[model samples]
Target: MSLLNEYRIRLAQEQDLRAALEMKLQAWREAYSSFRDEGFFAHHESQLDQQLAWWERGLAGGAQFWIAETGDGKIVGLAGGTPTIEEDQDTGVDIELGVLYVLKEYYGTGLAAHLMDTVLSRRDALLWVLEGNARAINFYTKHGFVPDGTSEELVGSWAGLREQRMVRKHG
Candidate 1:
């Protein structure tokens, strides 16, 4: 069967936390190595505790996470958003798109766009793309996200890797 044919997208549960973290760590290591310092790949190992904490927080809070998995149960991509209220009275009810990724092999299959559309369809949301990641910036801009003047990324022990925030509005 074709690789795309066996892929599935579904809401992630607590049971999927470990695998999901592994997927994130692996993908990040591979993708961000260039944008980040060279030593990150050697030191940044996937942490089980971090994954457990994330699962706990999502279950306790109203956060939801989605994962795209293969028929054999391998996590290929993940996208998550959370309920947040911004200070601005103009835009009430906000959801932040926290994560979106696909394995290298599926990079050109339109998975990221599909995931963003799926998430954004639920509400007017905000997300950020790394400044150096041209591909992601292009994808977000093409989908109608605009610059919101926010750029504070949580770079883990790496320099020059930060976030540039963007938002999408429906008139």
Candidate 2:
């Protein structure tokens, strides 16, 4: 209740990896439990290793990491930006909004919006939301992300699900 209101936001550091990753997994499990199969959640541990790899890269890449933690240092949410400086086949510089996860307890409490607002405020960037994830699609729309008519299959087991690429440019 009031305790949740006192949460703070800051850049995530190396030591926060364990808490951050755990928060991410908890958020995902809660968000997609209804949409995905029971077997999916039951067999999801292998995916954690892959996620750990990416989190490690984020730690090593020096990209900005933002986290929302309670007064007790419990991480409730996280968001980050992963940028590609190299010229791409399509867009010039690709800046990916790579992380946005909030614990289930905070999902309806505006924490998602808060994390997203902070992420977008950092810079102009693009992100992909799985087409099947209706909740995320609506969330991104409210944040000023409109469909660019571009999509792709996200690598890995998500290859079947369409990934909608949306961008917000700041002038």
Best by lDDT: 2
Against the correct fold, how does model 2 do in TM-score? Answer: 0.81
The alpha-carbon root-mean-square deviation between model 1 and the true structure, to one decimal in Å, is 2.6
| Model 2 Cα shift for residue 72 (angstroms) | 1.7
The C-alpha lDDT values of all candidates are 0.73, 0.75
Model 2, span 112-136: residue lDDT tens: 7777778777466777787878888
lDDT of 2: 0.75
Model 2 Cα shift for residue 60 (angstroms): 2.6
- TM-scores for all candidates: the values are 0.83, 0.81
lDDT of 1 by residue, 45-137 (tens): 635576579677876676777888987899988887766546422344367777888777777687777666666674777876788888778
**Pairs of residues at least 3 apart in sequence or in different chains that clash in candidate 2:** none
